[model samples]
Target chain A: MIKFSKQQLKIPQMSKPVYLVTGGMSKFDRAIPEKRTEELVIDAFLEAAEFIKKSPEELKEYIHSCYYGHFADHFGDQLLGEAVIHDRLGLDPLGNVGIKTGGATGGSTIWEAYKAVASGYSDTALAMGWERMDEVPTDEGNHYIASAADKDWETPMGHIYTGYYAVMAQKYWQVFGKEEESFRRTLAEIAVKNKGYARMNPHAQSPMKITVEDVLNSPIVADPLRALDCCLMSVGASCVILADEKTAYELTDNPLLLYTSAGSHTLRVADRRDMDIPLLPNESPDQYKDLGVRFPGGDRYPGFTGFLAARMAAYYAYGMAGIVDPTEDLDLVELHDAFTISDIQSYEDIGIRPYGEGRTYVESGDCYHTNPFTGQPGKLPANLSGGLIGCMHAVGATGIMQVIEVAQHIWGRWSEMHADEAKWKRFNRVKPDDWTDLQVKGAKRGLAISHAGVGSHVTATVLVHPDHQLKGRG
Target chain B: MTTQNRGTVKVENGRYRVTGNFHYAYPNDPIRDESGKLLGITNPADMTHIHAYGGEAPFFENLSNAKLLGTKCANPKCETYGSIYIPYRIHCPDCLMRNEEVDLTELARKGASVHTFMITERTGAFNTLEKPIRFVNVEFEGVSTILMGYLSIGEPEIGMKVVPIFQTKNPTFTIMDLSWVPAGTSVEDLPEGFAF
Candidate 1:
């Protein structure tokens, strides 16, 4: 028998503690053609400044540096985007750097800001992401987005962004062996549930209520994936301020701590195989294939590898936070639902469900606001800000947008925002008597997951309310 | 003795062979028509090319000759020694050893099955098809890697047997030169590969 010793996993610790002071995002929509990226950033920055209780000038003076995330300034034919934003904001000539990590650009920028504050280099730092995709035609915009895939292999074969997910959806259907109609209905349910939440979020672009039937009836952008299943391309910007413990206390009474963060990436999805498939058969006698196999490793399966990266990221973050089970430990979640299939796959990838059982969790309504598992209200509400599906995806802005939404839930300020009354009444076709049911009440801990490319890059973060007591700390 | 008063020194066997040279060009200059209508460019260059070495070179050359090739791990201790890779890599991912090139024509001749497929109806920059184009992820028998190519037939079903149809005539020396058609389709009936 081969003896395998337990391996110790190292979790990143900050030299100087970092805290999330506040986060804000502009209303995500396709109608923002008149608004420039700088204007959107300024709007979100001002909104975030309001939470600090400091004058605009004072807040500006406190910020030590700025990190901007943007995807394809060529979409609007603009260059020197970071310089333009820096000039418009009138920040001191300390330093401002631009970041680009495809869809995870927002989260990557935030991570950079966190490092600045955590490293004791800055007392306060600003991370912002914006995209003005509406400036170009749909094809031109798609051309910009397709630049994320492998230019040599994937793009030449006519595999666009939607086609990548569509292939995964098809493979998912094959692996599960469920009825075609039933599988599609489950996907539609995911769309309906997300759009239902979008109706409550004021920042959502398409907050209009949708049905499973409506999703199924929508035109197929890529087979197995409808127009409704894909996220809307919109123009928006999101900003978050990170600071040290002292600065956080000065900013607000309810500061959210950046507990743990992890990110992983694969240049191409084809390079890695799916984790769901059993690489080595249980009955096989080949010990080499069985023992050497690692999750997110091996090329036995053809499914998307992004889910494996997500799992790896989540494990690192969860380990750092001493969280054994994310599904139960997390009070709420903000996941990257760029596509409906992505949401379903995330459930399994994030350890919420076992392999090939993502659809089962979705059908059980366990992830919804009203938890069927506990027969209680707000068990673990996901994508309360409509996610990328209903909230509209501004590419680079999505990661920070997810962080902002999770922060809002942790602060218990989600329900205070305006929601369409009529649409709220018709939500899920099972309207509750009170509007508070829509909110995840007393959410002390939340997780935000974001990804870019075709599951090429992924980031997972855990946030805890400042008031919440830690296990060892007072 | 000659070092003190040598006007010129002769070196023996000093000539070296030049392995390669790199050329760089930029298309910063704009071009205009005779009337200065502002056309595109005269000597436009992207300066980007696929850098191929070792097994990758043969991988493309085989495609030009209407054949498929894969890389096999040379290390006997490697777990996936016998298995083949479609996009041939120089080093084995698991064992970290250089791989040996292998011909995959026989495995492909046995035909492959559709692991998964997607049809895109919405046209984009690369997808300029009048109708939806079906792209299939094929799993060649005995091969470890999956090859992504367009399906020459109509709607593709899971587990459908597919045979590789190479564009031998005037091949573009790209992965686009190869596609998968249904197993029973006659050689004369195979559709043309999708235009890149």
Candidate 2:
């Protein structure tokens, strides 16, 4: 591991070293039924490339490198659709190298881009992720992913991604004392909020506002989780243009900054790790105790109130954002609402509210975009752009979108952030000085948190607003 | 399209076995062999193995070549009684592997009854037209791979002992190679309009 100058790592509470020039992207998947993966990647490229306003050759010259994020298992799907980048932008092939990680390939891809800029490796680099999942049949697609799973223990048990997570959800329900309805409520809220948000994003794969009642009432796909709770089958591509501060100022008037972002992952097995979706291994009470779930009664972890990955990702995020206290500090937040329960659980895990008290935040109306329930000068308003549930996650791109979501709101790009919420109003705003006693006061930071679920593996990240902006954390 | 309903091969008393769902096919198509050689083919003997389980392999170790195997549920005396399956289930599906080690044994390629069938005109990867096709769910004696496949015989009847014919190229004994035949062949009492 390379060591960074201690000064570089030392982020001042109010201001930070970094400033984002600009990041551009296309919809999650642009080639659903008609185009090739190339078209999908090109869609995002053309979009961000347009912002450069440079001739084809000129844009190519600016791209220090290209990192293609993909999850295709075979050669045909290996590299990112760089063929499009070469043909359209006329870039040399050397810059394009396929970066493959499991489901979070996109999140990791963004992480990579973040590092590239911070390290001065690339003044302007294109981080693009794309997939044409619908081209293949469902069973065929499933077979490809299932091939990635452990063939020895999992495949034999007919463990699809669903069953693996289902088992843990079952176990978590039993361990936590949270009610199934509570968890369901959380998930449904996420789905509904996302649906509402997607309606604002014209490019969203599936854009339609649904109600929590509708989500809970949808057909149960795997016990408590309904078909709607799952992410959609998507073929989307998203790109983010990263530029150093000097380059960004030269390009655009308003540059979105990437203050601070951190990511971490755990083991991918139920037996190898003892964590559940709603319960961190280090957290109090086992899944059985928390959910009060019994093997019988057709209920699994019956007590889980929300998601586990949400809490973990949010925890790391709160730490990174310098948010020692959440309820009264964070001005605005966006968590990957892959499921609605994730949002509610995020409220508790991120310390927005006390444990088992997320419901209170919701009930008191301080936790929602419109609530400001705490009314403590400033309350943390969350998921103004819906989230993954709102945006319809396309695996890798979905995670990247979470980062984009928070940044858009901080930069006040909400009009272009989500189409449905184009006229969407900002929910809650917290004054820095009034935030729960965690700082020297007068710290304006916009915090963005993201969580991803790959079977059961989850990653959380926290992003802090830079030192230049020290009014209140947005 | 098939489903988890594929219990075509059964395991009983810890030994696995199956019955053949056979069919017939005319070869010499434009297809080439592994060596890419184009040879005109026409011989029953040369094509008969195409109808056997796993072809040249003894007892058809890998019947995936096209053989249809039948056996009882891995768990005998299940709550639903003796349900049949194909693809050799390791245990009772209802019990989801909870009940293991039911006995499986092979039986004659003949059948004892046909539970039911559906008539349709589907003719492609999807069923969307008004043509004509018949799908039958048949049962054989003792062995349990409640066979689901295409039926050529007209108007199937329950309890009628039926025989299966098979296709020629790469047969390896799956139900596609098999068609239904009358329990007893008699020229003196031929049924009117009975097509071969």
Candidate 3:
């Protein structure tokens, strides 16, 4: 069995605190034929400046350094894309670096910027991420994405990334789900819920008022995973400004305290060796001793059914943010719903539910904006911005968008940002007539999980209003 | 247009001796909306990439010989000394030491079982596999990790026993050269160019 040294499991301690001053996102769509990528990026930046009641030039002055996240240069046919964006943003003279970690590119960018601000290297920093997946045809785009897998081993077999996830879904279905018909419908409910929530999101793509039956009947891309159960291939830009305490207060009176942590595992799932399940703060050591007995072939810690990277990321984040039980300590969360099964997998990985019981999180309606059972606010609402399923999976921009979505709720501005008719009209999208306001009232703290292909990379970003900051924050 | 003179490479004098054309260029096409509004241009091109397998070269080379090559960690001082890996890891993940290659053909033939599987009708660009591809993750006895491969014949079910098949005839020298089928699949039922 694999083991971790004490040094490897140490909670990350920052020399100084970092805060998120402001963030923004551009209109997301399957394709944006009207504007270039740079124009979309500029639009997102202008929105960030306007949110803080400052001019673009005024906000630009606070950025001491920049971190740009743009995955797959081949997709855009442009190398040094970050340099091009940096030049266009007029932050040329400052030190800047490019970050790419497949699907976790956006969160990795924020992690870098948070470190820069925390280390006193920069008083303020800009973490910007974007993706342009529309340049290539859908099949060719899938090829580009599958390139993220091991080039020699995994990529050659059908060159489809979904098939890789499909294998894991099959294992999870049999072992944890017991291949139950009710379990299959429970997975469908996540799609229905996320898409239904998307109707209220102006910047979302693929907003459908679909039912669980519609999801069950949609064309199956891979067995047990229908087309609607998958995430959208989108084009958009998102960005956040992180700063030290003095600079943050100088920029905005109310800035959320931010803590970002990252973890990684073997790039190829085939190489993941068996190990003991790393316990989260909320778990007991012997809580999973009978896992293999309970679910045959489930003894393997992460064997096709779990994302160890997400678990490690949450393990570190919970310690750093003093989050003992996510269900009780956090107000809301935005998880990477790359696929419906992977979404369920993440619920267990991030400690929302114990292993083999992720279906309960959705079935019990605890993940909804308003729990259907009690007609009250969900104990912990999840993916209210529709996540990657109903929203956009714009690769480099996705994690940043999730963090911004969570921050909006805590800022009590989710309705202001999502309900404005003028903003929806500017993007040429019709506001849904039943656009229910989904603002989680009195939200004080939240989290966002950014995950990469399979379980290679994951990052957890926790944000807390200063007044509601939990104790033991580093 | 099939190009008979695609690029090929060989090592000579400690350097790559490349031959023939490696890239093909095509004219760009305009992309427009229904109103004929200019949107973008499509740049079409084809190119070949020469990739070296390095230390993992033996695994691919052995596939056509009807042999399965895996690696075992040989460092006794390491935490996972005797752990064996398929998909051929060149180094022990725990100790960063070179792994000793081991033949797993007999073991896989006798003991490999399907851990999980999927059948996908969709594939990405440049895929050569047949439609409705059945993908399986096969786990062998005593092996710490499972290996992913396509099933050459029959539907896959969890816990179903399977045996390895290799593209011994006109092999592509890729991971595609290796496949799996039901344990009792006869030689006549094998796919073209493949054998047990």
Candidate 4:
């Protein structure tokens, strides 16, 4: 499987273009004991309907089929949870399916809905996702997450998913990072930035104005990765509605063009085989010839350092969207910052920066909303919704929430949605006195990367304004 | 208090023969808020699962005997012929043909080295390993992939040579029976119930 066939590398071409009409998210937190899962799901759907100026009953009329994403059914002690939600939402008699791809479940659910609209099976479709990780204790929740790994080979080792994932972070820390003190601080800076961004997001689970030293001083889950470096294990719901061009305008005046592509690797990192690096349009074969000379042990393609799945997903997505380079082509990104180190790795995987040089994205002040060095807007701000690190990692709802965050900027409604005092009061969260608008000015295109455990499955979702889409798309 | 007899299973004539209790049920408890308002109930149960490894059973069965087993794609017509896998593949991924089981005990003993390692002091429920589990992804000289296991003794560093040790005595018949240690360690210093 290392070598690709010509057919396998073909760029996906939809019969017709699909557009994201509107999307919404509920208040995300570590636990919501006062309400059942159905209530949170209804809250998300009601917001989406409200955004488009439609009633819940009116929105349900356009949904021909349903796709629900709910990871770890065992955690909720409910089998067929999707059906329960579908019935509660009053969408029955129409075709519906469930998706479970670990952390990427939310994106994969949208991927299915997008294809349904593209293939002419349905003019409009509903993609809803949610998770209830609070039903069980933290230790039991960790065991449920680890079950996503190979149960026999990996789960028996420690029954903790973080230990299985930390090996890659350790390798990246040593080889590319060179175990430098400054490099460790750069990793901590991501936590500080994401948590700071979370303070402005009322739905965010963890929000704190902290320094890099605070992150370094946090408890060590594993060597080189502190407690703050990890993402939150949250509970919440989020959803999006996809439609064709004709139906999109009917639903909303502004609809962003949407494209989704996915890729996967072996469940166990132990099974990864050495392969030649798949070059993106921005890279050349000669560009990485001396990677080993620059950083020893860095020549290995995806050798516990790079996520081949993310790279492959980006490969197809960029091709489909007619993107040659991400940083220059896209306005911003919402990367899956499951861990600070993994966030750096993804910057390289998606071609924001070349391999072994992801640290530059953060240090050069390009990843910030406002460049700390230049005192101007950052070239490409990342994770403005606080990402998994600060916002929430409610498994099934995470990816959908990331895409909705990006679309708000494209719709020129980021301020309208986020700056509402009613929303803060509704969620019962106190609005900060110094809340700043994080809307990327003149945003035309953006991307969100949804990833699963240890690079097992990854999906790339690219949303561009129909007026700004690139010509000669693959 | 009841003396619980855990469930056990055996395959006889292609059918499962079960003995003792396979599941136990507990009374559901009401979960209420401080105001004594009803919200939900807790459901508790314990159960056992029967899993068959199928084609890869040989790899686990030989671990208790202090043997490391791997698989090789011997298909001459395939694109990737003679590729060795430590996490033994049931069949060649490139070709659907069955793979030949090859003993990798000697190869692992002579040339295994640590590619990457991590130490974690936290574990989830049902974890049996000691706190601060030292995980090492070991690379063999002629293997196509790396194998993940724990270091039984000493700290781990990249490119450090290590040798395999098995819990030949009172084996658990799981992946836990196999471990790794610094290559030149003396036999007397091995962990309890383990041998090189």
Candidate 5:
């Protein structure tokens, strides 16, 4: 029993900061038929613990709580996932909860663990995300993924996840003048580039070197989105260890301050009226009366507001981290690139460029290893780990994998056995003698963005190197 | 080629049959029902729906009668914002207050406009026909919620006027029982009391 204070409490001047000391992820593959979800989680956890130079005993004693992120329990033929994982790992009697936010499960789990540490509820917490997608067949797996959408309307109407994105792509083409040839070319470039990057990442599931022509030749699953445009359904697990500033310092010399934020919209895509309407209501219809189109209605196409939730989340994260210009300030980014078009959308959503200019940004070759715009080496490389497109998309693990990639960039740990030398050379252009060149040189700040279920829920996290100078902070 | 005597083998009909203790890797087994039947749910009937909460009972009941119903938020502030929910939300999401049931039968007659639409070529449980299936997001008149249904007649165009086409024969008493067709298109076996 606890006694409650009736008096008003004063808020603290500064909240405790949370840091990610180390992170680990299993190799993303199509199907690890023999490995169970619990086994995969344990493997990732051990690797994360090893990264912090901690022994098994130390890890068992240090972690105060655990948060597991899993999607589609039926896919794995398991329930009470967190409890099973905890018991299997012999971390019982500790606080644990399972989080499900579709594809953003990993990011949401990290956010929950960050809160646990920031609020002084726990000093150290483990965030693990895993999914066993290979247990089911392709069509069944698709059905499981589509379950994230509105079952009452979207699912019953035969709106598969890919079909929904296809519709959005179609609408985008209709409204934004179908530069079909150029638009398709740009999309192909994205697929080719990401896949090309994946060829260097040993952990990536699809590391085959592909070209723009290869992408164009691929069969169209959904119109405008070819087979190469989508990510492979992968089975894998990832873990990130979050601790208070003190614990993080004790764990590792290099620590990354994690600032995470999330935003949600209607679950159903049709409910996203923002896609066709202005952000701010048009109260002054007379102001635009002279315009040919209806003043109040404004433009029927507002350029696909599906990524608005992600934008909102990123805005909150940037505000917290005091980052105004993300494209210039952040050294690198790891975004959810489940689909090639999704990567293009993330560029605008994460403020790399203004709305309706994602095509221009990609075409400029800014997202590549060497930017044509600035001519700077490794200028704002997005998805250095092959992303979900080149890398495999393990739904639950993808968000955590993004965070891990950013952490590796910040810590200068790109030469870790998994980094492919040839692929690295292709991306960076110059020959590298050591691990330093494989990383974003002098990178102090990075961002990781993730979303779930047709961009209905989004999470954006800004990570800063502990020693980096931050504005308005001593 | 010379035969290896080290490995155990038996010959039958000029073909060598390996009889050694060889390890064979088997793929993960599929889930089966209690009766040992492969429960591969390809059709929609293989799935089950359990409506534990009765909040949506009225909405489904109204659908069977060729009528549409919505819930109006009871809170004054919510009502001021013109908040009404289809599928009949029992409580207002914004105000966190109970909502009053509202009959939207007349609004259904007026029909809705296609807000957005998609033409899918792939076959699925709902899109069973070989031809393309046009799914539309229809926004009803004066209703905030957008309803999703298939376009039964004509092509799907943005802002195209469409009306609900309820199944008068053997209604499923589910949302599936209702679809949408181009406005003014004759619908056979409509409910006697309805004026659509």
Candidate 6:
């Protein structure tokens, strides 16, 4: 191990010369019209504009450039998507780009946007994606995802997507010994939570909240996982606003100032020879100590396939924020609970509880169905915004929605948060120690986790809450 | 001797022909494992053969003689799961889970039933199984979807009992050695035993 002095261990906090704030989306997927590519991006750009009460002239002046992410079957359109979208916004574009990152096109898009703001390329840039994938037939879609697989070795061996996830799920069951009942109950809780969120969201395909028994009886997708566990194929668009600290104040009366943003992407899974060195998310187990995860021995106690990726991401975010003792500090998280299992693992991986204590945390009424930290009644909070599960996902826009949830939570739009049958319970409050850790000690650093693939990633971003008392430059 | 490789991704330089060894499912529609991997099927079970020279992966030679069937864990880590994986891994690359040639109890082929299925209107193998052909995901109690073949019967439903029935490609594709049927059935309801 490379041991360093305590003074040398400190990581430099990056400074942004310009701010790119607010990420926006125009629905991840819908029965989008087969129109010219320009029309689709224009619609998504307008949809993003709707989130903020921005005027054409004022919006044009603050907006610097745009980055568009898309994955079309063929090189259908070669024009700059940013230019096309910006032209509709009628802005003097300083920077405009378009990229494709396979299934992760959306998350990669936001990461690119964050880089632009950090690089001082444009003061306030827009990163957006629009894909109407229903056009690709299911078989053709299968072919597309398989295109990324090792064509000769893996594909010929009949290693398809579900097979890979099934192998992991089965292995998780073998390791955790957390029987089907445990997986079932966790999934039910996630489904109910997301459906509740969808009630407030008109765009969600399944807006009605369902019961645990309802999911238990549903058709099984794979052996253990049922239909309810999968995300729907829905059509929608969304966007999140990212701006500089000063511009954040000007963007809205309440602005979620992004404190630190770091993300990593892996083109292939098997290339990494060693388990210790995870290529993506670029963080290690030691880093978790900084992210406020009170892991004993500074090592991740392994359990669950989906949680590992997220844990790595959280560890990096923790390093950026210098957060320790995460279980007590952070309050209110909006993670990519892509599947029911993903939600369960986040509970343990994010240091809410020790590893293997995830199942017990749920039973003790901690993670979902009730706010564990605050014990707010009628709150089945996690993915209240229907998440990707209830909201359905089109890949690229899911991360933007995750950013929106954190913003909405800090904004006190309780309805926007996932709380079912939850009447505003003003009676309960955070325990004194917990309260200090959250409101004062860790309030400046709120953590958010996002994942990709089936248990493939974890992106934890620590958003430092801006305080009026702080003398830092606005 | 050296060519700065431009497009040399493909490795199968040997032209190992598989002519007339085409595998068919759903009467003709080929069955592919999820992730859209085509599960290799031989039209007639007899036509199915493997030629691994100086290779590994323990083939259960006297598998028919002994009630137990087994395969070596080319992937040792995969050994814990009873080698249940179709196209079983030699050393389980998935979990890094290790295992050797562990003893495995063969599944009771008699009580096999359709777990879940889709009467495909159209899919990858639409030509093989027609728009209305049944492609049920079946599990023989103790096994996975490792078993895939023709179950010539009525409508494929949940828990519909099917014996180890096989078809032929010109030549009769039949499980001649192990002609099995439902555990308990009336004489009138007996299946016609066929061997290719």
DockQ of each: 0.23, 0.02, 0.78, 0.88, 0.14, 0.04
Q: Please report, in order, the local distance difference test score of every candidate based on alpha carbons.
A: 0.71, 0.48, 0.93, 0.94, 0.71, 0.46
Give the docking tier of candidate 1. Answer: incorrect
Clashes of each: 0, 89, 0, 0, 0, 54
> What TM-score would chain A of each candidate receive against the reference chain A?
0.87, 0.73, 0.99, 0.99, 0.87, 0.74
- What are the runs in model 1 whose C-alpha is more than 4 Å off? A1-9, A273-306, A371-375, A417-437, A469-474, B1-57, B75-83, B94-98, B128-130, B192-196
Tens digit of per-residue lDDT, candidate 6, span B1-196: 2222322122266655444423332343554566777653323211234344221223223223333232343544332344343223344434454434533333544546653333323222112322333443334544332333223345554456655432221211112222223334444443343321
Which candidate number maximizes lDDT?
4
Candidate 3 CA-lDDT value: 0.93
Task: Arrange candidates, best TM-score first.
Answer: 4, 3, 1, 5, 6, 2
Candidate 4 is scored at a TM of 0.99
**TM of chain B vs. native, candidate 2:** 0.41
lDDT of 5 by residue, A207-326 (tens): 666788899899877666788988788999998989998888888888899988886666765544323211211123343233224222224323233476686677567767767777
Cα lDDT for residue B44, candidate 2: 25
lDDT of 1 by residue, A150-251 (tens): 755666665366776677776665555243688789888778888877766767787657788899899888767888988888888998989999988887
Give, for candidate 2 chain A, the lowest lDDT window spanning 10 residues: A431-440
Q: Model 2, stretches more than 4 Å misplaced? A: A1-16, A28-31, A49-60, A74-89, A174-177, A180-183, A259-266, A272-321, A326-329, A342-350, A353-367, A372-378, A416-474, B1-196
For each candidate, give the interface RMSD after superposing the true interface residues on Cα.
5.1, 16.2, 1.3, 0.6, 5.9, 11.7
The candidate, 2 or 5, that scores higher on TM-score is: 5
TM-score (C-alpha) between model 2 and the true structure: 0.57
Which 10 consecutive residues of model 1 chain A have the lowest summed lDDT? A275-284
lDDT of 6 at B62: 23
Stretches off by above 4 angstroms in model 5 are A1-14, A177-179, A273-304, A372-375, A420-438, B1-49, B100-111, B123-131, B184-196
The deviation in Å at residue A96 for candidate 3 is 1.1
